[model samples]
Target: MTKWKAVIFGFILAVMVKSFFAQYEFVGLLIVGFITGYLAHDGAIGGMWNAAVAGALGTIVCAILFIIIATLGGSLFGIFGGLTGFTLSGITSITVIIGYLIYYAIVMGITGAFGGALASKK
Candidate 1:
């Protein structure tokens, strides 16, 4: 498959896994990584780079979806009170979430690269 196909597959797979198994969301990333790497290998491309790109794309898509959901839920539930209150706690929460997302993406990318390396060896 092409790189775009791999990216789309990874994104959908990640989203589905995350939605169905919230507790084991990392598994979704791992699966995406593996699939992307395998596809890259089959395509005779740079397996590591392609897999990493797929991982990044999948993670980014998932993060954006989560952010949208969180924003809507917060607005509907009025979880943060007023803007003033949100300014403080919200900043911290957002920062933490962003940090976690970045870390998650990096880890997933590394995992993808590993999978790509394994595939290339075969």
Candidate 2:
């Protein structure tokens, strides 16, 4: 495959993987995919295989980061609300959780992809 093809394929694959991990973070995934495409084009990895590996690593890293951030944020927010004696409706609670997940995706995905690129030198 040509260089361009490898880049495109790797980007798409990266986006798909990111989306699978976090359904509500499609835009985040797309941004990461674009970054991976740039890295692939720059020969940071080598080809599609390397790009795929990098992308997968990036997704895993971001997933872990997001999980941690979201869980902690949610728990902390809940605790604060409880301390203040704020009663949250079911829908409100759900919305808060989903909102945390969205924040996690954006922060984690971008940082993780850059981290993956930095750590991977093949």
Best by lDDT: 1
Model 1, 7-71: lDDT tens per residue? 56665776676667778777766777677666666433454456556655655666667655555
Candidate 1 lands at a TM-score of 0.63
User: Can you tell me which runs of candidate 1 are displaced by over 4 Å?
Assistant: 42-45, 75-90
User: For candidate 1, what's the RMSD?
Assistant: 4.0
Least accurate 10 contiguous residues by lDDT in model 2: 41-50
lDDT of 2 by residue, 1-122 (tens): 23455345554555455557556555554455445535544433333333444455455555555445544455456545443433344445556555644543444345444534554555
Candidate 1 lDDT = 0.61
Number of colliding residue pairs in each model: 0, 1
Model 2 TM-score on a 0 to 1 scale = 0.30
CA error at residue 31 for candidate 2, angstroms: 8.5
Total clashing pairs in model 2: 1
Model 2 CA deviation exceeding 4 Å by range: 1-46, 76-122
